[model samples]
Target: MNRTPPSARTGNRRIRWPVVAGLSVVTAVITAVLGHQVPKSPSTSPTSAVPPQAPRGQHRDVPGEADGVVPDGVTVFDDAIPAVANLDPGLLKALRQAAKAAVNDGIEFGVNGGWRSAAYQNQLLRQAVATYGSEEEAARWVATAETSRHVSGDAVDIGRSDATAWLSEHGAGYGLCRIYRNEPWHYELRTDAIDHGCPRMYADPTQDPRMQQ
Candidate 1:
C-alpha cells in the first residue's frame, strides 16, 4: 500500500529554467528595441500667425553673419555688418547723427536689431511662436516677412535700457521715433518728426496697419 508513484520520480519532472531564461532575454531585447524612436529631420514651416505674404523665394534662407543676428557690442556705427550698412540711407544718416549726439551724454547707441533680411525676420517669427505658445501672440511681437520694416531696412532696434531711455527723450529730434508702445527698443525714421514731434504709438506690431499685409 506504501508503493511510490512513478510520476513522483525526480528524473521524470521537466526542468523549465532554460526555456524561461531564453524567453525572458528575448522579451527584454524586443522591449529595448521598441522603446526607442528614430529622430526626424528639422522642418522649415512658415508661421501660422501670419503666413508668408511675400513671394516665394523672396526671403530664401540666406547664410551669413548678415542674416539679422546682431553681435554683442554692435552699434549703430558698425558699418562692417550688413545689418548696419544696409539700413535705409536716410535712416542710417539719422542714426549716425543721433549716435554722435548720444556719445556726448555717454550713451553709446548700440544696434540690437537692424536691416534684417526677410529670412531672418521669418526665423524670428517662428521663434516667437515657439516661446509664446500661439502664433497670434507671436504676431504681436514679430511681424511677418512681408510686413516687417526691418526687412526693408527702415527699422532699428536699440539695445540697453540707458540707450533706449536717452533715445526716448531725444529720438524725435533726429526723426528717430519709437513706433510701438510695447517695444521701446523699436524705432523708425519719421523725417517730419524732427519738427512736428513723433506720431502716436501703436500698441504692438499687431496694431500697425502695415502688419496686416
Candidate 2:
C-alpha cells in the first residue's frame, strides 16, 4: 500500500490572509494617531512676528530726553531737550513754534541752555571764570544769577549754527531776538521785534544795562 505523506499534505497549506490584512490596518491607524499628536513648529508671518517701534517726537514719556534732568512741574516734547522744560511757558511755546517753522526749511533747532536755577547759574558762572581766568572775562560770557535772563526763564541758548542763522533772519516773525551780538546763540522773546525788527544786539551780555543792575 502507498502511504500519503503527512508533510506533503501540510506543505500546500495557505496562510490566513484575513488576519494579516486586519493587523496591517490596525498598525496604520496607530501610526496615524501618533503622528497627529506630535507637536509641529509654529508658523509666523511678516505682520504677526515683529513688534512696532515708537515714532520720533512721540517719546515724551520715555526716560531721559536729555541728560536725565527734567525740571520739576515742567513738560517737554520728545524732540526737545531737558533745557526747554526749564524755560518760561511762553518762551518755550515761542521756541517750539519757531522750531516748527524752521523745520520746513530743513533746519532743526535745539536748546543748549534755557531757564536755570539760581544755583545752576552760579555754577555756570564759576566754570566760566575758571575757563576765562577772571570774573570780568567770565562776566562777558555768563551773567550773575541775580541778573541772568536764564534764571528768569526769559532766554534760550539755541544749539547749532544753522539754527542760529535761521533765527537771525526769521526770528523776528516769531518775536525771538538774539540779545547778544557776540553770543549769537542767545535769544529772547522781544515782542516788539515782531512789529519793529529785533533791537540791535548788544556787543555781549556785559554791555547790556540790565546786567549792571
TM-score, structure 2 vs. true: 0.63
The per-residue C-alpha lDDT of model 1 at residue 13 equals 47
TM-scores of all predicted structures: 0.70, 0.63
lDDT of 1 by residue, 55-76 (tens): 8777656546668778899998
lDDT of 2 by residue, 1-213 (tens): 997698876654434566778899999999999999997767976678878887878843432434323444332243354567667787778888888888899988766677667777787788899999999999999999899998887988777889999999999998999988789889999888889999888998889999999
Alpha-carbon local distance difference test for all models: 0.89, 0.79
Q: Show where candidate 2 strays beyond 4 Å.
A: 1-82
- Name the 10 consecutive residues with the lowest summed lDDT in model 1: 40-49
**Which ranges of candidate 1 are over 4 A from the true structure?**
1-63
Worst 10 residues of 2 by lDDT: 67-76
